[model samples]
Target: MIRRLFSHIDLMVRLLVLAIVLASVLPATGRGYVIAQGVSNAAIFLLFLLNGLRLPRTEVLRGISHWQFLLPLTLWCFGAMAVAGKGFASLADSTLPSTVALGLLYLGALPSTVQSATAYSSLAGGNVANSVIAAALLNILGVFVTVPIISLLGGGEGISLGADGLLKVMLILVLPFIIGQLFQARAKGWIVEHREIVTWMDRLSIAVAVYVAFSGAVSQGLWGKVSVGDWAVLLALVTGFLLFGFGGSWLCGRMLGLSRPDRIAFLFAGAHKSVAMGAPLAAVLFPPAIAGMVLLPLLAYHLLQLVVSAPLANLLSHDPNVG
Candidate 1:
């Protein structure tokens, strides 16, 4: 059981470590940086295009009717989590770099993950269909909503998104997704047929984005700026945010009188932040150096969520009330 749980995490860690080390050693500079940035942007565009192809409109429509489940879930994810992120960022501002501190708020503004949330919900005997719809809706909304939230909360913290940044987001993320939806009938089938390839493409795009971003940061002295004590503080704060995400989401479910399965769906949907959205959005919203710094806390949170969620899902699967 333990082996099964750690196997996936082990592979994820290895890949991420490789990306980080590669970025550090051969950090992109000069004309190479420009090329890397272009590649990252193109990969992100394709990644969203594939995302749009995969998510069915029917699922989104069906899920919208369940306001009882969806409303609180949305509020918790965007409202409560955003507020918590602000509070944590305030706490970390004095201890960490300003950009990294602002990342806490950015993390809160992001949406729930689609793939992992639905997978864990199914594993925990939750409403997989609801999980799918909830995650999809949030991601769609996030495309429009996340930047506004950041601009609103992060204006004073040197994180404002000007017109150019907004346009970049539309071009890189939103435009490709709209195109994918338009061609979904034709391309979705091919995407499904080549699911393995599509999945790898998703991972590769994210890795490339991270690599470009981190490379910029490394070249700008990222390692020298962030010390051992700063790492400890970052980890501690991220763990606290994780706890609040899971615990507060569960309590919200209970308070709302959700059935066990629906609650399970809500729990995962509301708690998990999407790095799928984070990495690309950061690339679009900030320069490579700042984007890399902003991503530090999120990357840590993403890995820890995976580690914590596997065990939590296993435990939830054993709950007698989960039916």
Candidate 2:
């Protein structure tokens, strides 16, 4: 009975909720902010390093070789989703805050999740190899794609990155990744052996980033600016966004004539966004006051997708026709 109850709960979602609550209640003043930022930065780098060490290079190459699945998945995740976000934001401008609207756009531009997407793909009896490749490539490119996309979307008000700033951000993230990759062949067994620890480290870093971002916003009167009604509207908008992504991707996958497993790959990989990438990117791209709001939609979408996808994965797994 206890196991069943625990299985139903989303621990990551709970952790995020706790972070927000703590950020609101705690005094994250000068010293707190300094310490949090320092810790958050280190965590972010380590998270990427761990990812590089664990990334399956052979699977990625094999997945990419199958262009039939790769092409549509890429289009949906990067191109189509981004345009949809802009359209939604424009349509809802009067109701949603500018920061929140931009947050939706940020979500659209961000990459598909590697771990969750792959896990769901496997659960659903999908083409796990292809899912891994699609997810991996999207994230690898997201660091490059996201910055330019933000710049293109009216970056005059601090959304823009100067050449040096862009270079620095790239180097900070990319250098660690390269270093990890270099050590991966030698360290792969050890890294994979301690996979759970690495996973928790990544989650902890994101939680800390959330705490730091929200604490800064709270200190600057975040709750004062946002209303209860705003939360309701944001919830609805985020739900709609997820539905659109999932429905559209599924339809496109079918229309493109992908096989069952390949379609499942697209369905899972194309429909989700990465909070791991989103949180750190927001920290780099937006100021603290607005970063929290920018993060709000992502937090909502991330939790929503997991909740919705899990049941869908279960359904697909049980269906004899799916695999």
Taken over the whole model, the C-alpha lDDT of each candidate is: 0.88, 0.82
Whole-model lDDT, candidate 2? 0.82
Query: Tens-digit lDDT track for model 1 on 196-308?
Result: 99988998888888888899889989999999999999999999999999999889888998988899999999999998889888888877778889999899999888888
**Candidate that would win on TM-score:** 1
What does candidate 1 score in Cα RMSD to the true structure? 2.2
Candidate 2 segments whose C-alpha is farther than 4 A from its true place: 1-7, 154-160, 320-323
TM-score of each: 0.95, 0.93
User: Worst lDDT window (10 residues) for model 2?
Assistant: 151-160
Clashing residue pairs in candidate 1 are none
